[model samples]
Target: MADSTVKNTYVKQQITDAMLNLLRTNELKAISISHLVAAAEVSRISFYRNYTEKEDVLREYINTLILGWHVEYENSDKKSEEEMLGSLFAHFSKHGDFYLLLSQRNLFHLLKEVLKTLYGPKPEYPNFGAYVAAYFSYGLFGWIEEWFARGMQESAEDITILLKNRK
Candidate 1:
């Protein structure tokens, strides 16, 4: 089972990478599974085993990339908010290309949902409410999108520091 899981992850990454490479010069609609199979150098059977279509590969890749960090946040030992946010930034920096393409494709609806996971732990303060979570959900995502647009020039550590100091 573990071997299957590993192989599945490896093949899926290959397919997703191929799709991104294709997206460099072609729109999503213009790229077919055959193109992906050829580009990835994987068999059509391998592609079908991992994904139903080119978009599925990209969508799954983005969803996994976003959700994995939130899961880590939820499961981690107690840590400072800066450290947690820095971890998230580190993940984003590691997968900068994926996020960059997702941004260009305007495929960020799932990002808000992923960020909404942070709302699960509500506080008792007057300023802490669903409204505040909603505000952060939207505002933070917009800020992040803009940050990516500015070329992500800051290191993850620097980003964490800036965000921590931001009013």
Candidate 2:
């Protein structure tokens, strides 16, 4: 089990670097497993040993980020929602390039799940939490994608402030 864990870590690290480097030039759809293995200098068996698909690589990376957000939230002062979001954006912007690459993947489901976890059970809405989760997840991701497309023209705080000011 320890050996498998170590191997997985090594394979994942290699694949993550290869994918990110490839992302600088190639779209995710364009990057085949063969290309990834070659760039990562890992065997096909090794790749499959750690991940079933290329998208799994991205999923694991995002899981780390979302977990980090949860940790930050727990450590943070219980302030207004805007402040927490602004802080989260600041962290997101800190790793802007990786996130820009990440944004291309269809992470809507992931975001929706996380938002649902964050917001929990809100009985105030007539449609239950599904509608609210979808609205927040899609809207928030769309907003960030636009911000990223603009080359993150404004600071994270500015972006969050814009959202906060929205009527």
Candidate 3:
């Protein structure tokens, strides 16, 4: 990798780690740019150059996670809804600390925004496929949010079974 690319990645990672740490104990709206930069050990300019706002850091991290999961999902033999959901639950379970923090902080809505971006019913489009995709995304998000709410106590297989048996 180029020098600048490596530096930029380092800066972004620093900011992301700082944001997550802050979100653990502080409210999202309460954290200021000054506090974030101080916690991140990066300059304000660095933060602004890489991210427009605080939420962008969290959004980018979530996007990275979803992208990783997408790659795994693509590679796995997850042809059915049960298989796909089982994979998803396992992924979230592995990252339970980060996700549990988001749940505690009431930040799961950001996941919905990221999902919409990836599978959108674009505001201008009038198509059944778009609506179907959007509906599916929303429904999946509902399951994820509820799973987080329940402290993710159940095993992924158990949750998949529950979803399969839902009336």
TM-score leader = 3
38: Cα error in model 1, Å: 4.3
Question: Can you write out model 3's per-residue Cα lDDT over 30-92, one digit (the tens) per residue?
Answer: 999999999999999999999898889988999999889989898987789789888888888
Give the 10-residue window scoring lowest on summed lDDT in candidate 3.
117-126
Better of 2 and 3 by TM-score: 3
Backbone Cα, N, C clashes tallied per candidate: 0, 0, 0
- Report lDDT per candidate: 0.75, 0.77, 0.88
Query: Which is superior by lDDT, 1 or 3?
Result: 3
Q: Order of all candidates by lDDT, from best down to worst?
A: 3, 2, 1
Better of 1 and 2 by TM-score: 2
Off by over 4 Å in 1: 1-11, 37-53, 67-78, 108-110, 117-128
Residue range with the least summed lDDT across 10 consecutive positions in model 2: 106-115
Estimate candidate 1's alpha-carbon lDDT, on a 0 to 1 scale: 0.75
**Candidate 1 local lDDT, 1-167, one digit each (tens):** 99999987888778877888888777677887788888988899998877776666766766787778778877888388778778888888988877877677666554555666644325653655667777766767776778788889898889888989998
Assess the local accuracy of residue 69 in candidate 1 as a C-alpha lDDT between 0 and 100.
Answer: 76
Ranking by TM-score: 3, 2, 1
Q: TM-score of every model?
A: 0.67, 0.81, 0.91
lDDT of 2 by residue, 1-167 (tens): 99988877888899989988987788778999999999999999898878899878776777777778768877888578788778778877878767766656534344445555555445665685668666776677677767776778899889888989996
TM-score of 3: 0.91
